[model samples]
Target: MATEAPQRSQLSLRPLERDGFTARVLRSLTAFIQTADLKPGDRLPTERTLAAQLGVSRSTIREALQTWQAMGVVQIRKGSGTYLARDVRATSLHVPVTINLERQAVLDSLELRRAIETDAARLAARRGRSEDVERMRVALEEMEAAYAEHGFAIRQDRAFHEAMFTASRNPLYLQIFQQVINRISDAFNESRENPFVTEPYADESQPDHRRLYEAVACRDEAGAVAAVTRIIDFVESTLRHDE
Candidate 1:
């Protein structure tokens, strides 16, 4: 037997757009929960219900919730609805924060990303589960689709890295990377200097990502490390050339 969905109150903001608009949406949703006196462990409205209430599409709700889930603020249980995973203000205060990065800071961060990511790739090749391979594949296909539409993929790009971190079977790696992603992506996007986002290299990167996936899929540690190096090398060269 099917149960009926419940009605929800409409949010104040409507019609969210791009350019950090998603961040604003998340903020607004958090505010809604806070003002409503919602507490940790409180169940949230379903996506369809939330979208209707927020005057946005269900996809927007899903995206915001995904980010919130990643941030440890919310949890989605299969057939059990969503719940506030932690107290919002606590997570806000405890997570390591990233401020606006300078050019040198960006480079340093990339170097750190390169270091952590290469090792993570090697570990993924040795330790990856079947689910990990599938996730990388889905993220790759999403990247292709996003490229077909918008010339480059931003969220999919991040998703791929997140998949790799998960595939590595290393929780700390994913935790650390997620903590820095907002600042790192901001620096890369604002500069427009990423090899993966520009032409020639951008086109070349599709196969590179494929190769990285294959290396991990086959449990080829050396191959995975090499593939990661090749990808990061392009970024290092591009950034250096620009300098």
Candidate 2:
């Protein structure tokens, strides 16, 4: 006698509360995919269906789907529907840690950066090659040029620091920098919008980047550490004053 196939489980999503709704939605969707035994190329439910199931607005569902799409977890086809871009059975939905523009959180993030980056600066000075130094120079020059034209050099600034991390020649340092700094960078950007500030913080911080690059180029480990320390201290002082 032929046996019947096992029944597939239903997609059951709990109503998400207000706090961390996006995160909850991601978790719920992950659970639904697992329970439903979804595979790559499988189409997800309609926004309306997912919204109703999760007790959220269709916009919220769309936003979650868009985020997943960006992460390569899902693929959204215009006029068709969202489909799984990859098999999520062995994958966990990762929610990036968001740092609020709150005072303590900003300070804590800066402190953590200072601790890691000071050591990274020293390591870069010691281990960095000529090419690594050139990368820092290019990023710094681009940052200065962008700041001169736009009064903000967010991308170039990040690239400069990323170059520094790369120059450190430590994969772990680069990894940690990406994970921690990238997550909290939005908060730092938002903090610059404070109406009370006399000058653009980026302007004040520009020289520090150049100094850091110079130190690393010359292989002055102590100077590199000092430059990194000064940069963090200045940022901390500015934020503290704002508070």
Candidate 3:
């Protein structure tokens, strides 16, 4: 006799309102991405499977998946299982704990940073004023001081980057970067305020800042580009990652 296949078991998200099912699904999905280390092109379980895992109606899962699709977060195929889209703005920056985002988005952000910052660093090397270098040095000092006292220098870190952008002497770059900062401001605020996320990095980053300044101050365009690339590369290599 042929044996019957066992049914897949259903999971639960207790204390959830039936009406709030869709919202919960979205949050749960992103949290899974952040925690599970999911990445672009990674296949997600089927809608039926997600419905079971989330303890929600299959229709609810379908709706949430549709929303994710619209948001460019996921790609769906008729027979092939759903997948994370190749490109995403992780950190839920657009959505909302938005929390620490997944690795893909962090990598994406870093790539963007490298392009923009390297140009800025190079331009600053050519056109930067002595005052600009002074400001960077000051920001570096403040970063060191804050890192020494509080063990994390979020404000000083941002200030240094802001100063770098300003030194680029390009209003367009500054304008574009301001928007990027604004988009991440919420996540940045939460991360810095918590202190837990910022920890384990004090006394580091000093040399990178100094090197960047020296490159710019000495009018070393290629060197400035390398210095800035190194800085962003460190960030890309470190900090946030799970999948």
Candidate 4:
């Protein structure tokens, strides 16, 4: 006697009609996985199907899937399909942060960074290796050089923060920081001119990055936290001033 193939579980996703559609799709997918009791290695519905179910564009589905892939929530194989990369029941996945050029959103993102990065800086000061400190130094130098030549060091500045996150010896911190940075970059790219990329902002912010690196290098945990706080506070104030 032949046995029947195992049936795949169905997902019930409602159409989203709100701003930040990509973020909402991600949240909806995460909720579905939990409510449906999806296990690791379980394949997800195709992008086409998900888009239809969510009443969103294929591109939106792809973007949300890509974000999940980055977070290690799902694994996408070309020609095959997307699958849950881990057991959602065991792991807690926060909804990835999304940003826009909106004033309040930008301020909220800065606050989020302040909360995460300050603690990360303190951890890095306590536990960072020599190599980790070296990475921060190199990134800082590159940022300074880039700013001198181009009047903007957005890429280099991001590199500096990434180095800091790595130094914290926490993979989750790096992952969260990358998601926030990616959203911020998208917001800036959509705008005609990125305020954060301006000379005035970069000039004001560069010293704080150096201070953060120095504090981490010296294993000054309190100083590290203070430096990170100052950097975020400056950005928040700058944004408020513009409004």
Among the numbered candidates, top lDDT falls to 4
Clashing pairs in 1: none
Candidate 2 deviation (Cα RMSD): 5.2
Model 3, 26-48: lDDT tens per residue? Answer: 77776666545567988877888
Give residue 105's error in model 2 in angstroms: 3.3
Residue-level error in angstroms, candidate 2, position 34: 7.0
Each prediction's TM-score against the native? 0.61, 0.63, 0.53, 0.77
Kindly list the per-residue Cα lDDT of model 4 for residues 120-198, writing each as its tens digit. 9999999999999999999999999999998888889999999999999987888888887777677677465667767
lDDT of 3: 0.68
Q: How are the candidates ranked when ordered by lDDT, highest leading?
A: 4, 2, 1, 3
How high is the CA lDDT of each candidate model? 0.75, 0.79, 0.68, 0.85
lDDT of 2 by residue, 115-144 (tens): 889999999999999999999999999988
Tens digit of per-residue lDDT, candidate 1, span 75-99: 9889998899877652353233344
Specify the highest-TM-score model's number: 4
Cα error, residue 182 of model 1, in Å, equals 1.2
Alpha-carbon RMSD of each model: 9.9, 5.2, 15.2, 4.1
